[model samples]
Target: MIDFFNNITNSLIFNNFFLVLSGLDNTILLLLISLPIGFILALLFALGRVSKIIILSKVIAGYIFIIRGTPLLVQIYLIYFGLGSVKFIRESFLWYALKEPFWCGVIALTINTVAYGAEIFRGGIQSIEKSQVESGLSLGFTKFLLLRKIILPIAIRKVLPSYGNELILMVKATSLVSLTTYMEMTGIARKIMAKTFAPIEAFIAAGILYLFLNFLMVQFVKYLEWKYNPHLRLNN
Candidate 1:
């Protein structure tokens, strides 16, 4: 048993563990860039879905339906290859942004997260009490002020649990960056496996790293939830 453990620990898979750790920076970068972009886009899409304008709501709903229905891998491939195929896009000023694998993965993940988060946010918004809006108005708040000061805050709190799940999922999803040849955790693991021929060991190490990250994020979200729970007083 000791020999077996040593074999796993002393293998090339073990040495390459640092390489995997390095790739975490890339994974984190992707998450940081994508999360806020997803959040903003989600808010816009949610508002559009709830808009009084029929056409606006329909268009947003269609976007949500199409995006949610499609697989993320397909979406990534479409944006990376399909958009790159366009001569006009290739020649355009924006091509520089699309040229990088990092950006491609970011764009794909951001768009995918936005679609899902928007639906979550929409549900939270719809769940808000009509009395809250009326109360805001009674206090001489304009529509914009009411939404900003009252609706958005309450809706955000309601959506926090789901949004936290989405955030962790996004952290795992960054593994898909390997498909685009970005050297994230999974990408580095693939490289190590190729060199070491120890697929199981390498993958197990990578899985542990991901598990650690997700664990940290989960704890952070729990703390935030506790802090934000209005019914719970800190002094108590």
Candidate 2:
């Protein structure tokens, strides 16, 4: 027990604590960039999923299926390595962003999450009581107005817990970008391990950092759940 504590202290304090900490900036940036884009795109996809148009719905379903079925790492590889190899892409304006591991990671993450998020949002939207739609229609609300006024607000609250889980998953998923040499927390931890030959020490610190971040998010989500979900609270 004493040795474990001492080693962790050494790893964090005496080792490359600052360097590992520096990776937090990119980690935060990557999360901030990808999640919002993924979210907006996912909402659009979810709308497609729930659309009355058969072809549009099928196309969205196929996209979500392909993304959810494949590994995110493979998607990352295709974006960074496979797409990067294309002659047209290499010569085009898109290449400027595609060539950078950071942007590649962001694009891959956004694409990957959009599928899952769309499903989550679709579920939430579907969960709204059918009567709720009827109620809006009885009031002569237009489809677009009803959706904006009633559907979106309730669905967002309904999906809070599920979305919180997605948030945690994305936090961990960001670590995969380190493999592309983006030097996020996990990347920096790998470097420390390489230098000190202490995998446990480096990973333990990295794990702790991630754990704390996720923990805080979990608490925040729980608070939101408790706040927005008043009926559940009233039951208590």
Candidate 3:
């Protein structure tokens, strides 16, 4: 049993473990780049969906439906390969960005997340009391001012818990970036296993890293929740 344990450790820590660390860094970078963009786009999409403008709402709904209906892997493949194969895309000014695996992964993740976050935000927005909007208007607030000062804050507070889950899920979803040849944790594990013929150890190490990151994320989210939820804070 001791020998087996030592073998597992050695396999996972082989070659100074720099490769695995690099892979972890890649995953972190992907999340950092994708999350803010996703959040912003989600807000816009959500507002669009709930807008009184019929065309705008329908367009946002269509975007939400298509993204939610398709698998993320397929979306990644389409962005990375399908559009990439086009002569126009390949030769266009945007080719520089499109050619990179990192950018492709970011774009795919951002779009996928925007769809989900939009729905969450929509729910939060809808939950707001109509009286709140009326009160804001009575105070001479414009639509934008009302949203900025009253609606968005309350909606964000309401949506934050679910959004936190979405954030953690985004961290895990970075694993799919491996398909685009990005060297995230899972990608590095795959390479290590192929070279060393030690799948179990390599995968176990990667899994542990993911779990650790996720735990940290959950704790951070909890802190934010505690800080923002006035009722919870006062009770505590």
Task: Give lDDT per model, in order.
Answer: 0.89, 0.91, 0.90
* Candidate 2 residue lDDT tens string, 1-236: 99988987665544666667778889989989999999899989999999999999999999999999999999999999999999999999999999899999999999999999999999999999999999999999998999899998799899988998998999999999988888899999999989888888788778878898899879988998898788878676
Give me the runs in candidate 1 sitting further than 4 Å from their true place: 1-13, 233-235
Residue 56, model 2, lDDT? 98
Q: For residues 38-100, what per-residue lDDT tens digits would candidate 3 score against the true structure?
A: 999999999999999999999999999999999999999999998899999999988898899
| Predicted candidate 2, C-alpha RMSD | 2.9
Ranking by TM-score: 1, 3, 2
Question: Rank order by lDDT, top first?
Answer: 2, 3, 1
Task: Flag regions of model 2 displaced more than 4 Å.
Answer: 1-14, 234-236
Clashes of 3: 0
Cα distance off (Å), candidate 1, residue 173:
1.2
lDDT of 2 at 131: 98
lDDT of 3: 0.90
Alpha-carbon shift of residue 134 in model 3 (angstroms) = 1.4
